[model samples]
Target: MAKKTARIKTDTHAVRLQTRDDVETAIKQIGDLQRQLEGLAIEQNNELAAITEKFAPKITALKAEIEPVQQAVQAWCESRRDELTQNGKTKTGSFNTGEVQWRQRPPSVGIRGVDSVLESLRTLGLTRFIRVKEEPNKEAMLNEPEIAGTVAGVTIKTGIEDFVIMPFEQEV
Candidate 1:
């Protein structure tokens, strides 16, 4: 009876670097490819910038023309807002071209001198207005890992290894 040999599975598409020289060659190739990619990116950006520069003046001129017209339309709308919106029954005025809307933004609070306000709130016994945030102190946990690791919910990971390949390149 002949013994059957076990066959190991291998990825067909994977690059196999058999020796130190192969790895070095791969790294050099990577560096060359990176330089080529960067050059292409720079060329693409230059072309895009030239295109933008060519269009910018026309865009600016159009915008300059539109601004005063838009202001005039807004002024007209504001002057006859009640009639346009049918005496506050609707917030939008629908014309043949498009609709203009009067939108009320949600109220917002702006605070200046936050420290002084917080101190005043504290002195006035207005603790309800003050916010107290509570969270796990990871730095303290790292400082005392033995105690931290004993906690049921927390798992302290150690000796994590990562493989990295950095191709050599010259700085411009």
Candidate 2:
């Protein structure tokens, strides 16, 4: 006679358990997602910084451009005030204007800037002096060949130098 071996079957009510490999894989996937997110954040920050850096110079340059124009206006105003006092002294030998018309030709360029030069040359204070007339005098000094260069046309005044330009057509 042969001996029979006992057999047993496991029950379905036992708890399921996870392996170490599964836990490690989940942790690694989370770490990878966090690293990707951090990289994206850094890239976005760099792009923003580059854009701001590019515009900074243009903004500064624009401000620089306007400074010279402002300076020109300031110089013009200071010159006008000084001219008023000196011209008054020369004409009346004193500052007494109780009965004078203050409305006489408001300082060359709007009652402001470089009065002495304008007075000396009998011109209104302006960046350029151009004849507003449509036609030039045919027999005037502008037509003369000798001294025409001196009084021919508009005078351009920059801080560096003064320029005299003549043109067939007047600038309106």
Candidate 3:
């Protein structure tokens, strides 16, 4: 006579169900680690602030002493640069110690009274130079799927989510 034994199936679902307690324990550990990290970061910032405060006065004084000498050197360099324009280059010039160059950027135009400009544009109904800008309303977008689909260059992604300790809660 032979005895038959039933064997259990090994699958991911079975394994997950068996290890549910382990998963919960890992999540708790991660939460504790995050709390510890936040506390350490705050403590480190406070210590750094104290050290910076102790040295700030000396640093300021050193910078103040160097300013006049630096300004004199810069003035002399500018004079030399004007004289050494023989190479037909306006941006770059080399002096005794090092090379000096001017880096120019494209000019940008800024409007000061934006509300008045908008009002004028709206009154005149100008569409070429200026037009009313329509920003996406978040609540409206969430309620309307058709509008969300029509919008371009928008991306949806899954982000890492974690539990945060509430400030009002007592320490466990």
Candidate 4:
């Protein structure tokens, strides 16, 4: 019988910037470095996704098995919360586990029939009590010269306007 052997290996290399004596050359080198890093990041993410895909079925099965137990535990906690608090116990019995306590929250409301309600409020002169929110149309603002000039100052500015780096091959 033969025994299998395990081995560890590494490939290390030094990288130095090769460029002409100018700011533009250095900038180009920096842009190339950024693109290389981005490519490596994408490759690593794809590898991780493949590993996750391999384990997904097992993970889903485990979750399905534990779901009923989780629901039972949740019900038990909710039912016993008042009794536990009354007995001056803010947490569960010490089994090297964390505490669980009930929390108080404000009730939430959902509005329906918004148009009818708005019309009623306007008819009853109760418009002041009703809140109105208005936002500038971004497409119209950008397309119209007058509107664009007016709203450009207050609009959220994004992206590089003057300077941008893109992958480009050197001319022969």
Candidate 5:
């Protein structure tokens, strides 16, 4: 029987050039860097989206909140300015009718010409001074020059040379 010959092996330098370890190391480093970049990108995107969401609605809501207030303030300012800047508008029809009717006031009357000094008192406001005694010139009550006007249907007379001011008392 012939004996089987063993095959001879050669350590070729070229065949050993590309080792599995070097290839594995390079692949591992590349994979790690890729994973880190993906993580950083996801984190950045999340942060930016959150920041945008936080302020975007707030800006609109602030305008919505302030719009009515701004309009109201503007309206108030315009009204006040118009009121302060009043132009003279001559109101018709109700002239002198109720202009002096708002509140009770003292009455007075004035006179123009007369013969006697007491009879020249054309205007008189006070009815109380009607029956009062005269000063300096002592004269009879019925002999004075009668300046006549009425108060509450009661006829009053005075001889003063100036306006007679009535007491500021009236019925409601």
Candidate 6:
């Protein structure tokens, strides 16, 4: 096997606006390009909508044909599940065309009226079921930066800056 060579890229032609006139021209060009991009996106979406509208009726008909057949197959399989799965020894039944499986979803807990439930649990001495989460308080740390900064793993970051350019456009 031949060794693959890595292709490195370098920025040789970077934009450098020297004067106010050049900056103003660049902003005008950015606004024009943005308008062109928005026009192209609208055209592409119109074409996609036309294509979807053309095929939507056929898709609806196909789905209507499939639902009854799927229901029939599922009912037949469910009625003969004991024989198909060999008396619950397996979860899947293999046939010439494909295999069908019976799956049990994992159990989940649902809660409603959280405040009342918590109060009842506390009154009944069932605190073990109630969870208490303990984590670092970042807001408190921000309030007391002097004390928080003294910690070994924590560092206070400052003076972050970003450069942004917005080209103004007039609505017609």
Local distance difference test, each candidate: 0.84, 0.53, 0.66, 0.65, 0.49, 0.83
Order candidates by lDDT, high to low: 1, 6, 3, 4, 2, 5
> Please, what is the TM-score per model?
0.71, 0.28, 0.54, 0.43, 0.27, 0.72
Instruction: Please provide the root mean square deviation of candidate 3 (C-alpha atoms, Å).
Output: 13.1
TM value for model 5:
0.27
What TM-score does candidate 3 reach? 0.54
Q: Residue 87 of candidate 1: its Cα lDDT? A: 100
Root-mean-square deviation of each candidate, in angstroms?
A: 11.5, 35.2, 13.1, 13.5, 49.1, 10.7
Q: What is the Cα-based TM-score of model 4?
A: 0.43
Ranking by TM-score: 6, 1, 3, 4, 2, 5
List candidate 2 segments past 4 Å from native: 1-19, 66-172
TM-score leader: 6
Model 2 residue 106 CA deviation in Å: 39
Which segments of model 4 are wrong by more than 4 Å? 1-31, 77-82, 87-100, 111-129, 132-172
Candidate 5 segments exceeding 4 Å error = 1-18, 63-172
Model 3 lDDT per residue over 1-172, tens place: 3322222233223234347687666556655666677679999999999999999999999999999988887788677766665554677777778766667799997898988977787789874657547886777666776657576965433344543322221255
Off by over 4 Å in 1: 1-15, 111-129, 143-155, 170-172
User: What lDDT tens digits, residue by residue, belong to model 6 across residues 1-172?
Assistant: 4333222244344569899999899877776777778779999999999999999999999999999998998899999999999999999988999988999999998999999999999999999989999998999998998999999999877555444555676353
lDDT of 4 by residue, 113-135 (tens): 98888899899999896986898
* Clash tally for model 5: 11
lDDT string for model 1 (10-65, tens) is 33445578998998997777667777787899999999999999999999999999
Cα miss at 91, model 5 (Å)?
Answer: 42
lDDT of 5 by residue, 47-156 (tens): 99999999999999999999998688657645554343343232211224321112336997765553343443325444444455656332442344352232244344
Number of the predicted model whose lDDT against the real structure is largest = 1
Candidate 4 local lDDT, residue 71: 85
Cα lDDT tens digits, model 2, 43-143, are 99999999999999999999999999867855654466446456555332223533111225555554445566556455544535534457755456435
lDDT of 3 at 148: 77
